[model samples]
Target: MGQRMKPFIILFLNLLLCQSILAPPPPVDYGDSELSLKDVEQLLELYDYEDGLTIDEPQVEIGTLSPIRHKAAIPEPEHTNIFSAEHELPPQKPLPRLPLPPDALGPQTQRGLPTCLLCTCLITTVYCDDLKLEYVPPLPKNTTHFYGRYNKIKRINKNDFANLNKLKKIDVTASQIAEVDEDAFRELPHLEELVIRENQLRQLPELPSTMTLIDASDNKLGRTAIKNEAFKDMDNLQYLYLADNKLDHIPVPLPHSLRALHLQNNNIQEMHEDTFCNSKDMSYIRKGLEDIRLDGNPINLSKTPNAYMCLLRLPTGRLI
Candidate 1:
């Protein structure tokens, strides 16, 4: 093997000598102490070493390439554009108000509105108080409790509550009502409470038999204003307040169901023994008549010491 390698080594030396002769001179700066770039390249060429392997360059198919494109621009909305100062929507007209239908009754309001528009009407209650009204407004058919307090009403017309059969209570307190027709509340079959206090009434109109409470206090009612038998037929009369008035004597023949009778601050100076208790019937005991106010009257309770004999409690007045 050494003999065969001797000839190849000699051939390599000869090729290197021939290359050194054929190549141009190297740069003068290249030092003889170190190998130069040209010397190394020549040595590699002479050896001709076989490369182990090579990676192939990737090939691209130009025929499958897609063209560049751009999307269409969307138009800007006038109301949504932020770059422009005048981007605003046009003004729209408001809807018109509707008119009332025909067949409406009673007087029109100052603004041509209905009576309910002037007053407030809940389910079955009408509140016409503190409205500065001059007359009673026409109430709804289902009105059960009507309040016309703190108004300027001068009179109570008979037809004010004519066909209102469902009316139960009428409160006209603190008004300027001077006159009430005879039948103002006469036909109201279901009227239970009537409050006409703090008014200018000189006479109380005839009330229905269903009355349970009658408050005519702070008025101008005299002794004759209330009929002697006004409360005789009222079997359900319970509370009667006629205080701060001009009553002269205790109204006689009170109903058996009378529980509270308030006639304070009146002109009452005398009271019979039977005003509250029956002397003829010694067994009669008014157990239900427990509250009676005669405090502010001119009557001397000592004059009729036996007046309240059958009462559950003594009358509240000046006893001495």
Candidate 2:
């Protein structure tokens, strides 16, 4: 009986030891602490001595954000308009009128033959016809206008019209006048018009500053240079006729006041860019000038690239 009781007591002691080892510890209350999957798996493995533990798969969902909405929180970029930029201002008013001299209406003199009879005489006009004089006549004192056509006058002398301060017009057209002296019309300050057409002149003489018109067509000017200090100051000059001449290169730096320039039937081959640079002021006058006749001249428009036809417009005749 004693041996059987000893076996039962040993079995009971083994069951009590197994229960003490398998019991879990008291749960600790850690406030607001996130537990990782690895930590939870470690805790379950530490207590799973009799049964194995398995974990489920974790679920995750993702969303995308817009880049435009992120930029809207920041300040917008600066903007500007590109159309309102300019460098110069427009012209405001018109130019003033040119002022004439106080003594612009004075009388003029003539210098030539004394025997030349005055065929006809008006208030300010004089006509001498069929005069076979070899030279210009010494005009009467205070003679403002003179007409000496159909005569055989050859050359013009010095101080010819010295005292003719009011000489506004002179007609020597259709005469046999050949040569003109250097000081032909020196002191005629108010002389405006000169008619020397259909003559045998080889070149032009020194003209005056107040000459507004020059009718020098059908002359014999061959290879002549129209150079004189008097031409530089002719601000009132408008008409210039160099037709039927033998000019090869047209004169450069034309007067700014010239409204009509005729170079027809000349032997001009080429023209420079500065040829019409000085005539830019004629556009302010009436009609603003039109016509540039290069018909008779031998010019290459391709070689002369900068030529502007607007600078050759004239008031009286075409720009030939």
Candidate 3:
């Protein structure tokens, strides 16, 4: 019996010793313990055997995981606003009509002789017939006047008065003259008067400073304003005849030496208040001017009251 008990005891002791060695040494409380290779292996094996857990396939929908659609949906462009438009402007008016004189009918006339059989010979005069002559040659060196009335000359050409330094007068009335070149009176430095009435002149040609009188009536001068400087240099100009022309206003700053001014049958409607501002000096030399014909201008009464009043006060009186 003792021997049997001894054998049981030995077996029990052996079993106790094995248990103590296999048990994990009472878990070391190392706050955050690092596991050894054996512990990690044990944990993995335990997790593998623990559950019937299966991984789910990632859930996917039609629009999920796509970039956010932030852009605005595009619509078609409108065409109504591009087809609306507007209109345009108009044009200007035309100028008035004016006639010209007839042409010279014969050869160039001699400087000092009667230009035609019908003309009378005079010491200082020239005369020519109505023919289609191109130019009128210069007057003779000794000639002092010219008379080429009723001729068909179109222009007063170069050297037309070349050596007529003593020329004092010219009479080219009733001609077919459309234009006068600036050089037409170039050499006539002492010319005192010019008579170019009864022609179809649309505008007055420039005159020289030596001229004292001008007779340019019965022509078509369409409502043109005479520049003050036009006669400023003509210190000798005393008489000016602008009747039967188309003037609408009195030219300002008239010549200081002017003793008479004729403006009959004009289209004149107004007179500038200062038109005679410079004429005060002329009264002393000529004892006041002779006439200011405003007869045919019906509008002058109302449009130029001051001028009418001033004219009435003149020493020689007015003509309206």
Candidate 4:
């Protein structure tokens, strides 16, 4: 029995060995195949050759990206307002046809100058006085004198008389004006007389060197209002009215060219010896300041006799 089983076992062992030897070898792991430095150089050379090909040659048939397209521009919207049309102010209509004047009826009116029912043929002098106007009216180009008194004008803007080159005089008295721009009348080259009286002006505006007369009364003007040597430069100044204001003392050493000074009702309590006359010599008189009104003040004329010695008359104030 041992001899017969040995041959069968040997045969089976041989068959297994033969099958193992005959079978194909297992596959090897050839991970991601990386190109070597030399292979990369060869690939670049091939690309260069392809790029150098002529237009008719198909170098390396490849697809292309689509071109970019720009969006269309939007149009501007129509004029719109947050406020309703009914609530907004209506467009100001043009003036109705005016009657014929002695001058060229249509041509004179076409000057675009404002018309006053009360104004006469003399258009140069626009007299809108005492008409209870709240604002100053636009004047003509050739206007020389303009009067807009007893109105409710609160402020004097710089653009009030902007380009009126021929304008010479402007009187806006008793108009309840509280504010005045510093350059309101500074640009005018020919402005000689300026009357802004009986208003609420606290600080006086810069006076033009060409100014000859300035009337600022019935308002508030204190000590610091008049800059030191304020009126010294005005060589041609003659009449200066500063009555019924808040001045504490007389603007002493007043300009020699000053003719009339209406400081009647102010806060002036005293006047220096050189206020009107030269202190070194009392005989020296101030003939130009003859029309001085110092009434309604706290100072006494009798106390400062030397102060008014050169003057023709004394100031009208309490003397104790």
Top candidate by lDDT: 1
> Model 3 segments beyond 4 Å from truth?
1-121, 129-134, 225-228, 278-286, 302-305, 308-320
Which is the winner by lDDT between candidate 1 and candidate 2? 1
Quality of model 4 by C-alpha lDDT: 0.73
Off by over 4 Å in 2: 1-117, 228-230, 278-287, 309-320
Q: Give a tens-digit lDDT track for model 1, residues 194-307.
A: 999999999989999999999999999997899878898999999999999999988888998999999999999999888888999888899988889999988889888788
Model 3 residue 39 lDDT score: 62
Per-residue CA lDDT of model 3 for 15-100, tens digit only, reads 43455479843433334895443563354355452233222221234765878679787898776654355433345567665553
For candidate 4, the 10 contiguous residues with the lowest summed lDDT are 102-111
Model 4 alpha-carbon drift over 4 Å, by segment: 1-121, 281-283
Determine which window of 10 residues in candidate 3 has minimal summed lDDT: 50-59
Give the Cα lDDT of each candidate: 0.82, 0.62, 0.62, 0.73
> Residue 309 of model 3: what lDDT?
41
Model 4, position 14, has a per-residue lDDT of: 51
Model 3, position 228, has a per-residue lDDT of: 48
- On TM-score, the candidate that comes out on top is 1
What's each prediction's TM-score? 0.67, 0.55, 0.55, 0.60
**How does residue 26 of candidate 2 score in lDDT?**
30
**Residue clash pairs of candidate 4:** none
| TM-score for predicted model 4 compared with the true structure | 0.60
